[model samples]
Target chain A: MHATALAHSNIALVKYWGKRDRALNLPVAGSLSLTLGGLATTTTVHFRPELESDLVSLDGRELRPGSVAHRRIADFLDLVRNDAGITSFAEVETANNFPTAAGLASSASGFAALALAATHAAGQQLTDAQLSVLARRGSGSAARSIFGGFAEMSAGTRADGRDAHARALAGPEHWDLRCVVAVTTQGEKDVSSTEGMTRTQETSPLFEPWARTVDADIAQARHAVETRDFALLGRVAERSCLGMHASAMAADPGVIYWNPTTIEVIHRVRRARRDGLQIFFTIDAGPHVKVFCPARELSALRSVLSQIDGVNDLIVARPGQGAHLLES
Target chain B: MHATALAHSNIALVKYWGKRDRALNLPVAGSLSLTLGGLATTTTVHFRPELESDLVSLDGRELRPGSVAHRRIADFLDLVRNDAGITSFAEVETANNFPTAAGLASSASGFAALALAATHAAGQQLTDAQLSVLARRGSGSAARSIFGGFAEMSAGTRADGRDAHARALAGPEHWDLRCVVAVTTQGEKDVSSTEGMTRTQETSPLFEPWARTVDADIAQARHAVETRDFALLGRVAERSCLGMHASAMAADPGVIYWNPTTIEVIHRVRRARRDGLQIFFTIDAGPHVKVFCPARELSALRSVLSQIDGVNDLIVARPGQGAHLLES
Candidate 1:
């Protein structure tokens, strides 16, 4: 049975940037993400006895035999075989509904889709927690990608890392929150998380302060989401982002990702906030900005942004679902 | 008089990336900076009614009649006039040892020196606290420049921000910690702290997490300094930088400033750490990386770093002192 598996990348209200354990892929703290409807990856897996190696393709591009992505898949298979007694060469094909490498947590979605598809292909049933652990081995945020809607990956106080897994905080329909992504560029990241987090951990003096500070936001954000306090959610998310960047500056060579246009849209939003316009914003990875506002404010926010200099394109999105089997 | 007045730019560890109180020039968070040893503007202030207008020169260059620095000086004069019950602009000539507009906090140090000089020129007997408040109005981190050694500006809870001010954490002798600065590029910042912090505040979702996380590090860092635990201090500082960058990723147009070479040095540090090397790194607003190894390990760390791919220049700095008037 080769059922297509589809998974959505959750946009973190409280984002994850660094790691506590790079090997285990454990995070420094808990984070909350909204599963977005517009951004997702779908994959299909099938095992063939005739094939000697596992095959992976993304968006119709056949991966090179020893590419990082393919290696990741093969290595993951090795782990699963050693740990879960799965011994099969699987051919896997994956596709993204949204733009790849656009700072949209494609790896989170990609790995989650692969994990679900491959596990199902093996004819073995696994719990969501088990699936999450498997996904985390690939990317720390991928653990959270196994679930949909409002989810939290608890930074449990254990080296075993079993404590760090995703749990649904609220369903997709809990609140009518809208996210408008201002997509700037889609290029390969200069520093991959595997390496970036390691450098930050070793070099950044500001890292410890940032690690301990976000817990309150995590609690507050969850509470805000539960109560449908959209304003609180937006405000807290923005605060969390600032705190994270403060640590970045404290790193040995302080880093900033904002271009001139990024600055303009931010001010436009701030001006809106000052003028009592209802919307809040957050950013992740690339130069793109994601604004969390009510659906009603979309037109006004867009109008304001359109008038501003340097803002490129805005993709409107709402809460999305988790990894699922799609009938071909 | 102006003989005792010293000006220093307030540099943010938490950095005032943005300005919430634009008119007051209040930063989002308190920053820490070292008052340079060589360059300081010393002026003996005496209110003279005979002068038609205030005379101002920066490093032998006379300021035009209506420049911003001139306007700022004028504004400072007016403020001191109202606060200290004094009037009349005194002639001010300031010289900076460092290059102007080189992203070296020259304006901060310059204005701080100018404030000190002006206040002394005005014959105002202001306390360090009062002077800090005055300095903060000029530039957020300048308030901390009033004191030497490790400084911390209280991120006060007061809404009026009257309680927010800089305090000395320790004297230079607290730790033998050495900071080796590698200057990557000498240029003007594309975005100032006022613009950067504001963008972070308004746009980055990761900012809040960063804000929440640093408190623990602040406490630990202070304690580490008190205890003189170099390893702990380095660890705390490194983490702080990571948290800051995490928020940058959450910004609308996210960024990681490390070029391939920068990344290589960081990776080298991590590799060394994994191999049981004891060197720490931290970064600020620039592309350069600062290593915080002890003076004992300085030679070894530097030699190892020299072999790395993208390092340009390395300047070693010890604990610097507060701004002082240099003898002509």
Candidate 2:
């Protein structure tokens, strides 16, 4: 069987930072995110009995079998094969519309699409929650990308990881929130989230308290989303982002993901808010910033953000759909 | 009676960040610092019976009586008067060799000198510990400046804050550690550490854990200093600095102190370390970075840091003496 799926990238409002279980990819805290429109990954998977081994290519570049990227894909495929009880070698090709590994949540879309495509290609039917679990096994944020609009990833108590998955909080039409991604650098980050998270969890003394208070953040953020309280949501989201980055920075040797441009964008966002604009900023593990605001304020947000010296480009996105099968 | 005192600034190897009591300026965590040579603040205080009001001047500029700086001076004088049982208005003159409110710890030396000079000029005799306690009421880190070489400030459990004073860990001859201060920006920081600490303590979730773990950090750092372990001291010191800044960054509006040049200095420090230099970088709540290393490697360290794009100047300092009376 051959299957294709498309998944849009997500920007976490309440970030899923440290991992509870590194092997199972279990998060220490719950997270919330909005699947973004305009930037996505389309992944295709084909299981062929004639193939001797799995092959993986990203953006038309065929990766060597033992390389990190190829190994990650192969490992993810192994999980799908185990679930479906299939031994056939597979060929996977994935491409993203935005920059990869530059803190743009590309992995969320990539793994979400791969999970759906690989599972379907292997003739297995799974619920969205099950699919989310499978996606999370590859990348934690990918679990949230399985749902549209507002989604929450539960940091389940189960040791088996059966309950750890994403659920849709609201659909795309729930609110008219928009995200303006101020792309500072398209280059990949020096430290990947996987490495950075592990380093922080192991080395940072602040990680315990950070992990301890994440539930409160998630609860407050969820309430704000339900009530459509823009200010409250912005406050919680920005706080979560800064806390996560702080944990990384407090790590041994320190993982500083922010550049000078990142600070500039943050100051600009704060300045705009002070000037009566209802925009707030949150950054992932890279220098780029995502400004959250309503569609009405898009023009003003763009004007202020574009005026920044180091901002390379801006990609505006609204709430988008979850991973779905693509007709081929 | 009139007295003059001089005190040098101190940089916290283990930072005294959040306050346990805002009104008394009591720290939530104990801190360790190295009193710096070559940067001193000289303060002179004279008690006069005829004067109706306290007069204060900084660097030959007469401050208005009701101004914030003047008020702080007057309030400090009131404390001295209460202690010495003298009810005389005072004239105060203070000057710093470095930038004020720029995260250079000028307040540390300023208050240390003020505490010593004001008390002596009022015909009051106090031990170094009492002087440290008095200085802390003015600025939290100022307590550390009352001791020379390596000093530790106790985060006292008492409500009266008598135990929250600095003590000398090692005199100036104990270690040969030198600090190369890379001045990225000479301008004053936008947010004062006093305001920034309060903001973080009030808003940052990470502050609680940061405060909780500071004891362990202090113990480890103290051991490193006792053992004369440069690498261990560097690691712990760097961790403490990052954690303090993390708490600040996790504040509601966020307090980001690093600029592009600051980041460049950090990277250079790391690169230099990898190249076999025994140096580590720590930043206070400002753009400047203090690179700690041995005196033997000062020239090499200077060459590397000076080549960085944003470093405006470098000041090299060794362990220096605590506050002492200067003959008028």
Candidate 3:
């Protein structure tokens, strides 16, 4: 049996930083995100009862069996097999519309699509909520990618993390905004988000204080989304993004992700806002910057970002749908 | 009465960010700093009975009446006048060996020299600790410049700040270390350090957590200094510096002081460490960076910093003497 699924990438308005439970991938706090239209991944999973081990590939290249990426996918597929009660291996293939380069974190879409495809391929009939929980085991942010438009990851306090899952806050049609992603640098991360978050929580003195502000930020973002308060959303989103980065930077030895271009883009975004662009920028765990603005201001913001010297590329994105089965 | 004093600038190893009591200029935590040799302020205070108001000038440019700089000096003189019980106005002329350009905060030396000269000129007899208390009224970091070589600003728990003052940790000859000051940019600051620190305390979510780490950093640094453990000192100092700036960056609108070059220097310093140069970088509220190493690495570190594209100037400094009377 074989199944294919597609999922879109999302950027957090209220960011997910450290995790409360690393083994369960339970986020330290609830976060809000808007799914993007252009950047996405499609995954195909096929079960082979006679095969000894799972096989995984990205784009057109096969990942080595014991490689970090290959092991991640195979380990995730084991959960799907366990749920379906199948003594079988699987073949997984994933492709992304965006480049597998720096700045873009494809894990959310990749894992979300994989979760849907693997479960369906394994003869498991799981609901979207169940799929969201399963996807989180592969990647924490993948839970949010299971829903469309604005979504919130609930940082449930349950010891077993049964209550932790993301839910849709509103549909794509609810808010008509654009996010222009500025690919500012090609610097590879020294540590992955999972490793870095652990470092921050353990060593950074500001981690607890930063954690305390997340609930209020998430609350404010929810209100802003309900009322279509772009300014309020922008304010809290920017604050949340910077506060998270500040904590990471405070870690012993520090987890510095931003290159020179990242900082330059930050200044340009602030300057553009001062010149009345009405745009706010948010950065994930990498060097790229995403500028959020009204649909009408998209072209202007793009032009502004394009003029920046080190901004190699600009990808325009809008709110899009959640992970869904691909009819193939 | 007339008196002249010279005070050297100092860079905090464990930085001071926020204040406990804004009115009394009480620090949120104790801090340690190294007095720099070349960068200094020599101030001549001449108390006169006939002058209508205090005359203040910097580098021979006469400061206009009611100007910020003029008012600051006049206000500081008021504290000295109160101590000596004299209302006589003073003519204050101060000159720094280093340029009064961006990145270098002249306030530490300026206020320290002012406190000593102003008090002495006002016919007031005060110990070094007492002068430190009076100097802090003008600037918080000035308190640490009261002593030579290594010094600590004690954050005492008294409401009146009677127990709060700086004390010498060690003499200038105790450690043969050098700091290479890399002035990366000439960009003007959007907010003064005092205003920025206040904003961080009021608005930044990461403030309290950052403040909590200071005591441990201070203790670690004290041990490093006592034992000449360069690595330990560097580790705590860098963490302390980054933590303070991290809190500032988490402010509401965010206090962004680093320009592009500042970030570049940070990367270069980190990279050089990877290449076997054991130098640690620390930044204040502005864009400049200071590289700390043994005296032998001074030339090599200067070469490393000067090779960076936007590094405009490099000032080599060693442990220096405290504020003292001039021969004028």
Candidate 4:
């Protein structure tokens, strides 16, 4: 069996920072995100009876068999095999159109594509909800990438994590918003999201309160999306992003992900908003800044963001489709 | 009547962040501080019947009568006048050895000196505790500056704010520690501590948790001080500082006090510690970093800190005496 799938990266309008369950990758808070149009990952999976072990490759480079990346893929494949009741080994190949591990949410698109491709190649016909849950086990944010446009992940109360899967809140046609990604650094972050989250959860005294307040923020974000209120959406999104980073910064040893350029971008965004541009910024664990703006103000925001020193490139993305398997 | 006093600036070993009563300038958490030896503010107060208004001058620059700084001084004078039952206007002159409003705790020393001078100038012989309460009305951290070496400010439960005052933990002779001030930016911050604290209290979700846990941190820090455990004291001190800054960063508009150079200094301190040097960093609402180190490591810590690019000046301070009358 062989399958190929494409998945777009999703930027959380309302963030999912800390996790409730590390093993299952269950988020502690509800989050809302928009699946990005241009930045995506394409993955292919082939299950062969003749194969003895799983092999993983990224952008044509074969990863070491027992390496961390390879082991992650193998573990994900095992989940698919258990579900499909197939003993055949698989070969998985993934490639992304954007930078990896630079706070671009590449893992979200990567794992989403891998989950769809692997499950389909294993002769499994699962609904998007089931696939979302499965992808979440690989990377929590990947659960949201299973849906297009506006998607929400519930901080589910279920102990089994059945209710934790993301669901589509609205399709791409519902809003006319644009995201301009200001790539300050192309290199991967020194600390991974997994490690950073663990450090934040363990050492930050503020983490508990931040995690507790996410439900209200998610509700506000949902209402802002429903009303198509760009300003309200931006406010909630930026606040959530700041709160998440705050927890990380308050960790015992402290984690400072922002550089001089990052601070400049934040100030620039504030100045633009003061100058009557309806734009707001959100950053994940890395230095890059994603400015969300209304379609009409996109050009103006782009001009300002482009002039900022240290911004190597800019990517404009509109709302896009969810992860889907391609016929093979 | 006239009086002059000198007071040393105190850097919080544990910070005094939020205020429980904005009007009275009462803290939401108890704080510990080390009164700096070299940085002092000298303030003189003279009351005359013919003076129409309370005139204020800082470092030979006469402040406008209705200006914010002028108003704060006049307000503080009113408290002293009310206690002594005097209706005379006063002229106040203050000067500092260190930069003002660069988060070197200038206001702490300034108000403490002014409070002692103004009250005495008005013929009121108040105790140190009474002077502390009056100084806190001008600046909260100034309360701790009324005591030498290790000082603690109580976050009193009294609604009247009478119990919120500083008390000495130990004299400067109790410990052989040094503070090296790394002045990264000479320019004043965009947001003042008063404004920043108010914004953090109002907008930051993390502020509640941060305020809630300060007592526990204070206990830990006190224990560390008692046992002469530099590592444990430094750990608690740095964590408290981080938590304070985190709350500011999580504020609605967000107040980021650190620049790239500030971050570099923090990393350098951590590196020095890893290399067997006992040094820790603490920052207030400005870009400068203050590194606390053992007496033995002073030269090495200074050498490393001096090489950092943006560090304009370094001030070495030992624990010293608090506010006292300056003979004129």
Each candidate structure's TM-score, on Cα atoms with residue i matched to residue i, is: 0.61, 0.95, 0.98, 0.96
Question: Which window of ten consecutive residues has the lowest lDDT sum in model 2 chain B?
Answer: B185-194
Q: Pick the candidate with the highest TM-score.
A: 3
Individual DockQ of the candidates? 0.11, 0.62, 0.76, 0.58
| Model 1 chain B: lowest-lDDT 10 consecutive positions | B8-17
lDDT of 3 by residue, B1-328 (tens): 9999999889999999999998889999889999888789999999999999999999889999899989888888888887789988999999998988755668999999999999889888789999999888888888988899999989989999877888999989999999988987655367778889999999998898888888888889999999999889988888998899899999998887787778788888888888888789899998889999899888888889999878988888999999999989
Candidate with the greatest DockQ versus the true structure:
3
**Tens digit of lDDT per residue, candidate 1, span A103-169?**
7788888888878877777776679888887888877777877887888888777898887888888
lDDT by residue for model 4 (B228-327), tens: 9999999999999999999998888788787756876887787778889999989988888999998998999989999987898898999989899988
- Per-residue lDDT for A77-123 in model 4, tens only? 99999888999998888898877755788889988999999988887
Ranking by DockQ: 3, 2, 4, 1
Scored against the true structure, residue A141 in model 2 reaches a CA lDDT of 93
* Whole-model lDDT per candidate: 0.68, 0.89, 0.88, 0.88
- Classified by CAPRI criteria, candidate 3 counts as medium
User: Model 4: DockQ against the native?
Assistant: 0.58
**Residue-level lDDT tens digits of model 2 in A171-202:** 98999999999988543257877889899999
**Candidate 4 positional error at B211, Å:** 0.6
Which structure is stronger by lDDT: 1 or 2? 2
